[model samples]
Target chain A: MLPRRIYQFFLIYLLGILVLLSLKYGLQLSDYVIPGPKTLWQTALEVFPRYALDVWNTLQVALIGQVMSIVLALAIGIPGRSTTWFGNFIKAAAYNVQAYPIVAIAPIIFILLGDGFLSRLLIAAMICYFPILLTVLGVMSEPVADVEHFYRCTGRMRWQLEVKIRAFENLHKLTTVIAGSATLAMAGTIVAEFIAANAGIGYSIRIALYQSDLARILVALLLIGICLSVYQGLLEHTGSLVKKAWTGSA
Target chain B: MNGKTGKRNSLLAAAWILIVLTLAVAGAPEGRAWAGTLNYRLKWIYNASVIGDLYASGKGYFRAAGLEVKVRPGGPERDALRELELGYADFGVASADQVIRAVAKGAPLVVVAQLFQVNPLQWLYRTGKGMIRKLDDLKGRTIGITYGKNDEIIMRTLLAKAGIGRGQVEFYSVRLDYTPFLRGKVDLWPVYANTQAVFLRDKLSRAGEETALFVPGDFGVRFVANSVVTSEKLFKRNPELVKRFVGALLAGWKAALDVKHQKEALAILRQVDRDTPLRILKTQLEITRRLVMPRSGPPLGTIDFEGWRQTERIMLEQGQIKAPVKILSCLKPML
Candidate 1:
């Protein structure tokens, strides 16, 4: 084994090297956003207040997008297993949407829908719809022949049976699909925001690039990271609540 | 199995609701016939003097043309040529080097109108640091060159003119943010004649610090700085549209050039450069106008072959460009 003192020194040296490198190239991302260092701190501080509302707008869009994607997945998935047509159509739509890049479609959406919450919402929905739909379809269509036979023998009403019993059975799969949709939806909103927004994190980044303020760019990235973390935390919290509710009902 | 399908139907309804919610947010666009149509990419950002000119052109004259020019202010990602290539923009405000490089790379971009008659490439240093009085002293000095193809090309040429060889001078790619010149960071940096230098002076004036500016034009490297460029396809397809567009722009330039229009142009630029003081902008515009305003021999919008050749030779020597580009093909006459 290496000596303890030597290991400590090596670790410190590596950390020091990493710190130096981050400082050196850290400005690269910022240079893409803001151009020069002139009055950078002041400019960033001033702009931060304006972005509060923009961030709120982004969050709202992402939340709606996640919900929509989850819903789409279930709708397509449920009927898909019954008939190949339903399954193929849903799968094809998802794949086709994914095939075209978001950047290409965003401007057109802005043109058609006009620049506002609606255009961004549609862009986000388009993004979230495919993945969730596919997931839900797969989960909902999973082997349930035994459950169906039991209900049939009992002559239970299909509506009461589906609502009261069958829906609760696939809780784990539903939770997983929803989690994935949330992540995908966030990505969609940000990418869509890049094209037409006069405000939001995307607009801020775009302006930061033009001005050449690297610090502001990094700040925006940091803000996105925070937003993602909070979103994930919320997703997990909601998942637990869902699990608890399902357990209590059962 | 049928029960799962029932639940799925309800989820689909939720998705539709989301789409409707988004529709609710997209209200009618505010004001004007030309709104949301035009997109413009600037060569740089709000701090540059050209922004005022662009703003004046867009809001004042170009609006009359029914063109709502969205000035996409530039930074590192503001590759004017790339914007055209990606179809993100209709037109771009770029430098000659950008146009030349794009053309070299098989991009069919043409310079529509010349904005700056003289380029603003200069070395800014402390009043007395090393033997930097003449170009030759630039040898072995560490120079800070931020970004821009022209900055890199011109600095190389200025060094060559001073008899400095490759490896004679160390280069720091970091921009001079008026930070204290650390020995390891850089020795000198290329500064714009009006903006960066003036910005530094104002900082000094406000905080009671001392600094001096050295203009590159004084040392004999004068090339046109900002030029209006569009795709060759656009030019060919709508020659009259291009002419009409340029005609309106020239009027904006003429207005901006006048002493009276300085206040209006500065106000427009301030929308972008909230950090840039008006007094400093006026000083920069005055100095830059003097340096870049057209001379008697060459008419406005004229590209000097000799000037182009000098830049071409320097770029070739420095390995900035592999092959020399003929400058005449790049020019689009306004008349």
Candidate 2:
């Protein structure tokens, strides 16, 4: 799965590059508008190491952000799974927070938090937790009738047991959603850096953008793609392991 | 027919090709006019800084010149140079650094007219914290600069000229919010002298604070600002069209800057910039006039060749561009 993900990303990146190249040559565009192969290669050589480090920094934030989002989502989701007023209130509040555009709120965050790592982490979690929370809420709310019925009839259906049964039954769905959200986490972190943060691949890309250096941006995108693919692949692999262990198949 | 007849026909064909090539090189006739809706993209949104451009469009100067120009606004994401290459815009406003960098990378753009004779970019600081009487005053100050922006290049140039090392002063990364500057967290925040300077000074004034501007030009750092631009191909192919457009634009500027037409210009600005009060817009326009057309300065839209060269040299010294782009060659001033 990891190898497949890497190759698939490679193919997509290659296709995107080819399309840019075709446009460049087709329209007789200069390197400023669209970087030629030589310029792109030279830019890669120049900025690769710096951008790699930056991407690693971004990924670290993203990984922590993903974990935080998962925790926050599960915490809210598990408690809000009930049909009580507290659950409904929590759902409405989370939805309201999501409605406010992050771009609008990012300035306040930066002003309060000073555009540091903490701000990036919070923005990333804010962006990534919503979809995960929705899925968690759906999965937690829907009763697993057959398995949950066994626990309920014998009066063994405590809230913990109820949650365990539901989570166990929907383990595959939960794993898929969590793995899928890695992209969101990375995207969120990037958006944070692009808006205000000073130390990440997104910030570097912002600098390149200001300079109108398409070659540098292309190089940054390549590194970001590779790093994201590898991280996501590892996440899926870990999720599979967790599933196996949970089912006693490990 | 005789062989002489065939020789005469071949000579005629060659003469026709030579004539056509010569005409193409000399450019189309001065009398010739192009009739089409052309796109003129500004570097910023519709604000007092773009009064002349808006005046031109709103007052039908484009139509008077026998052209239909769609004056489009630019923002952070809108790149006029790229748009020119992609054939989306016929003309644009770009800063000297942008033009030089684009040219360094082989983007075939030509500057036709300079808008701001005195660049509007300056650092605004509160008056209480001792004036920047000399370059030495800049040391030990926490300055706000957008890391990958023109202000950074200008500030670095200023610091280097003052013989200040990187460790000598503090640099705060700036963003859209001015909370840091407002709360007195940073000194020497960059702002456009004509627009943001006016706004910020007024805001600080209400808070019982006095402010001053640090003009880079005053310190002999004359970085060129917004200027009219177009593709080199368009400039070469239709010199008459370029001439007419620039002529109309400068006329619009001259008229807009005229005190008699202040009401008209303000009305046009009010249409788009509804957020700013009329009083502030008036002040911005007055400040803009000084930058766009300084006293004893050249006529409106006059290309500042020396200023552009100095700007290019600064960029080169600062490693913003890998090498000189021969920026003067790209200054195909219509007037």
Query: Residue B177 in model 1: shift from native, Å?
Result: 3.7
User: Which RMSD does model 2 reach against the true structure?
Assistant: 10.6
Predictions' DockQ, in order: 0.03, 0.29
Q: Write the per-residue lDDT of candidate 1 for residues B117-216, one digit (tens) a residue.
A: 6676666665445545677767666787643346666776677677788788877654223342522245676677678777766765576545555556
The DockQ-based CAPRI class assigned to model 2 is acceptable
Separate clash counts for every candidate: 14, 0
TM-score of each candidate structure, all chains considered together: 0.50, 0.93
TM-score of 2: 0.93
Q: Where in model 1 is the C-alpha error above 4 Å?
A: A1-250, B1-36, B66-68, B130-133, B147-149, B166-168, B180-185, B205-210, B294-300
Candidate 2 lDDT over residue span B81-198, tens digit each:
9888777789999999999999999999999999999999999999798998788898889999998899999999999999999888999998778888999999889999888888
Q: How well docked is model 2, in DockQ terms? A: 0.29
- Give candidate 2 misplaced runs (Cα > 4 Å): B1-35
Tell me how far the alpha carbon of residue B106 in candidate 2 is from the true structure, in angstroms, after superposition: 0.7
**Listing every candidate in turn, what is its Cα RMSD in Å to the true structure after a full C-alpha superposition?**
19.8, 10.6
